[model samples]
Each structure stands twice: as structure tokens, then as C-alpha cells.
Target chain A: MKSSVRNQFEGTIKAIVRGEAVSEIDVETAAGIMSSIITTRSMEEMGLKVGDKVTAAVKATAVFVEKA
Target chain B: MKSSVRNQFEGTIKAIVRGEAVSEIDVETAAGIMSSIITTRSMEEMGLKVGDKVTAAVKATAVFVEKA
Candidate 1:
């Protein structure tokens, strides 16, 4: 689906940490490792596994850039 | 503070949409505009305004990467 949210990075799954409700996923991008949290159900629905190619999409609102 | 969360982007604030509880923030990076949703209180605490430089940090658990 089309979205206003930007910052999409194509990467490979580096790791997955399953929790009770949320699952932590790490994507290795050229820039660095992009981390994400999603519901375990979504993780199961996606059938995500290590070495899989995925795109990390972040909404501008969810991004917090620190001043430097 | 140190964090395990990765995918930090250095960028400038593009826009901010203040809502009753949550606020939408947009950061312009070389890659694109990274959108983020933060609490209005956090926004105020950060004293975030347009044209400010900030780093967008995303926890691996909070990020969702879709397989393609």
C-alpha cells in the first residue's frame, strides 16, 4: 500500500528475538543494522526468518532524530 | 544515554504536526524524509521545532520490515 511514511531501507534479516507479545527484528543495511519491533502474530504472518530480504519502513512521526 | 536501538539517522526537522496527544515529526535525510510519531509531552521535552538537527533512533522491535 502507498504510504506517506518514508525512510525505507532494503536489508537482510540479521536476527530475531521473540518475546511474549512483541518480536525484535534486526535488519542489516549498508548504513547499519536497523532494528524493529512487531507483534509476534505479524512476525508469524510474515514468516520472517534470518537471511530474508526485507524493507524497513518508518513513519516520520516514529523517528526521533537527536540534535548534533 | 546508551541504547541498544539502532538505525539512527542524522537529519533536519522538516515538519511537525501537533495533535492532542501524539505529534508527528518529519526529518529530511539524504535517504528521505523519516517520519515519527511521538508523544506531545516528549516533543515538548525535546523542545523540537522546525529546522532543528536530530537523530532518529528506532528500536529493532519497533521497526517492521516487509519481505519482498
Candidate 2:
């Protein structure tokens, strides 16, 4: 919500899985479960844990729009 | 919203600019204007035009969550 990223979703942490260098976090937002990978160090520094409410931010450049 | 992208927004086409290979599109969504660059070929194939209603989708992997 505070990031420069315009697209933000408020969600609860559903799961957390640790990898070699990065951690996979699954957030259960109203739309769906949004998954992302971040550095384990950042995850620890942020003190993020399962069930914690978080805001997932996606840069506008990373978003693709389409029509059907 | 119809694609595999979990993060999607329904919005009206705000602006579209064509480039040599990719095109920049701006969609005015409820939150904000989502901007993206896509292949001009795909843009033409989709017949996307300004003022059309479209959906913006973001890959989960491209999303990042943080707390403040």
C-alpha cells in the first residue's frame, strides 16, 4: 500500500515455503491466492509470517491487459 | 479475468500508443491507470482500440508484498 506500485491487494498470508535463497509466499486475497517469491533475508527482516495481513504490490509495467 | 493471470482488473481503455514492436496501453481502472507494453502485433490481432473495456492481468510471480 505504501509502495510506488499502483496495483496493491490486501490479503492474508496463506502459506510460506522456504527455498535455497528465496521464499515462496501465498497470499489469499479476495480475488485469488496470489503467490510471489522474495529473498529469505527480506522475509525475515520484514518479520512476515503465515496469517499476517499484507499488501501485495505489482508494478503497472508488470501488468498486462487484454480483452475477450 | 478470463486468462490464467490471477490479478486482473476491469477498466476502460484510456490511451494507446504504438511503437516499432510494442505498444503502450493505459487502462483507467478503479484503483488507477494500469500501463503496459505489449507486442503491436498482438494488439492488432486483438483489435484493441481506445475507449474499449478491457481487463488487466498480472502474473502472480510478478507480484511482491510488503508491510510498513
Candidate 3:
């Protein structure tokens, strides 16, 4: 899914779903767009907060980023 | 932009683009799919490494994840 449009946004962590040690960040961007839920086990490692500045860099490609 | 096909994959960080403090992770998933470039300044915060296992949770929505 390669799109010339590099979708990027910055917002606050409207919500956080704590799964095990990993956490899902729900950032609210401009308009009514709910950015994808980013999964990370270490929020402190990423210095992420409920109202911290962050950017989601989406690449234009089709690749599954999961575990076995 | 909601996609029932929640595209998720697991791979290694083939490349890393250092922009200031942020780093772009290029994870190589199954087939020839180059997963999106995830940007993060504190990789240790996310416990991400060059050969560390990671998952990209892509939400089917259109909300820019950038900075202002």
C-alpha cells in the first residue's frame, strides 16, 4: 500500500490500553481522524505520555509487522 | 479509513533513518512487504532494536500523525 501521501500526525494519547506490558496509544489528530493504535510495551522507554508530543511515521508499503 | 484487513506483520528493522532524535524503523515483513516507517526518538523506551521483534498496529482510519 504505497501512497505518495506520507500520512503523518501529532496528537495526545487520548487513551491507553494496557495489554500485558505493552500499551496501545490512541492519538487524536486534526479533524475527526483516529490515528492507528500504536503498540508498544514500554511507554517510558518511548517517553510517551497521555499528553506528550509524538509523531507516527507511516511508510508506504504492505508488510505485516507482527509476531509468530 | 477502516480496513477489516488489519494488516499486521513481524520482522526486523532492515533500516533506520535518524532524523534529529527520532529514528525511522524499516521492518521487513513476509514476502516483499516493507512495513511502514515508524518514527521514534527513544527506541529504548519502546524496547526496539535492530533485530528485536516488533509489531505495527495499523488502524483503518485517516488521521495525520505528524507534528505541528
Q: TM-score for every candidate vs. truth?
A: 0.66, 0.67, 0.39
- Tell the DockQ for candidate 1: 0.51
Q: Select the stronger candidate by lDDT from 1 and 3.
A: 1
Scoring only the second chain, what is candidate 2's TM-score?
0.85
- The TM-score each candidate achieves on chain A is 0.89, 0.86, 0.58
Pairing residues by index, what is the TM-score of model 2? Answer: 0.67
Best by lDDT: 2
- Kindly report which residue stretches of model 1 are placed more than 4 angstroms away from their true locations once superposed: B11-33, B36-54
Candidate 3: which stretches are off by over 4 Å? A1-5, A33-39, A62-68, B1-68
Output the lDDT of residue A13, model 3.
62
Query: Which candidate order results from sorting by DockQ in descending order?
Result: 1, 2, 3
Per-residue accuracy of model 3 over A7-52 as CA lDDT, tens digit each:
3444466766656654566665442323444445445556666776
Q: Model 2, B1-68: lDDT tens per residue?
A: 24566567788888999987988888887656667778889889898889989988878678888775
lDDT order, best first, reads: 2, 1, 3
The native-contact fraction of candidate 2 is 0.68
Interface RMSD of each: 2.6, 2.8, 10.8
Please tell me what DockQ candidate 3 reaches: 0.14
Alpha-carbon lDDT of model 3 = 0.50
Give the poorly placed runs of model 2, Cα more than 4 Å off: A1-3, A66-68, B1-35, B49-55
Best by the DockQ measure = 1
Give the TM-score ranking, best first. 2, 1, 3
Question: Per-residue lDDT for B41 in model 3?
Answer: 40
